[model samples]
Target: MTSDRITLLIVDDHPVVRDGLRGMFAAADGFEVLGEAADGVEAVRLTGELDPDVVLMDLRMPGGGGVAAIMELTRAGARAKVLVLTTYDTDSDTLPAIEAGATGYLLKDAPRDELFTAVRAAAEGRTVLSPAVASRLVSRVRAPGGAPGKEPLSAREREVLALVAKGTPNREIARELFISEATVKTHLTHLYAKLGVKDRAAAVATAYDRGILG
Candidate 1:
């Protein structure tokens, strides 16, 4: 509810994306688009110069990747909050950017309102994540040993997890497996314990991340 306008620097390798974002933010109230950069190196330089409140950063670039820029920004104690705006939602992409000090992670497919909300939250130094990214992170923390380990999932559990990854509901999974709903729920609980997750989405993310599912 602060009356001050939030400043932003849009960093992306694609010119079309930059133009679209710049236009979107320009049309929206309470935000000012400071500048645009096509690579991480330029992004870093601009961030230093503009000192924007939030930086909409893309992951992959030619000169330097977003993760590297994020790390550099953190090391340099830059004031802008980096909000990763990328198409990748996998652990390989999300984990590194976050660990490198990105303030938030959002997918390119997010709704315009969601993007605005994420930027606002990031400007205030709050953590924001796309739903898929959040589930992946939660799955990582809940996974046994905090990552893929030697404790392998059981064959039945693997089957259930595979179906879950395919967006199958418990009832559907049970019907397909010729098992009762209660049995499916039991299998899910056991798998959750073994995988160190609390929900279906997290289980799927952890499975994919751990190579339990392709």
Candidate 2:
């Protein structure tokens, strides 16, 4: 990994997609493209060898598939953050990729600036998701089929969680609910403690898993 630049590995079965992403990064200043992989198997090998700061991964591939590759890489202790890049936007597609340990998900149509921003954020351990995808993921988690292994939160907590899942700031949520920001923070603290999550993204994921909000 280069010390100065944000190194990236582009992984996709399509040569066109990989090349396009590489060029896009190359034209930008903060990102340096380290390599490319045409399949999940190659992605795993590259993760071990190159150890890029971020991996721009595609979910559908011929060998090892995107999710499978992420599972393998993470299981083997690869340090790179996986950011799933795909065309699909459904709850099923987003949830599985996240559950399998993807740090972020961006649609192929994401604005270039947003994509680069997400890459930078993911490289630094912050989660990023396309707003629509984030909302869908949150809604699904709060929907039915969420509470099996996890306990549900109170209705007010669910409302707070839904706003959080939509990326609302604490102050903003407070305003929306006609409550104090401290109250919002208090609720988030309790929500995190109960869900065993430390941040907004994890809380959102857990909310969906537990059917606390939709």
- Candidate of highest TM-score: 2
CA lDDT for candidate 2: 0.81
On lDDT, the leading prediction is: 1
- Per-residue alpha-carbon lDDT of candidate 2 for residues 114-173, written as tens digits (9 for 90 to 100): 898788778876677776566666544442444423555778888898887655678889
lDDT to native, each model: 0.84, 0.81
lDDT at position 55, candidate 1: 92
Residue-level lDDT tens digits of model 1 in 45-85: 99999999999999999888999999999999999999999
Flag regions of model 2 displaced more than 4 Å: 1-3, 143-198, 202-214
For every model shown, what is its TM-score relative to the native structure? 0.67, 0.71
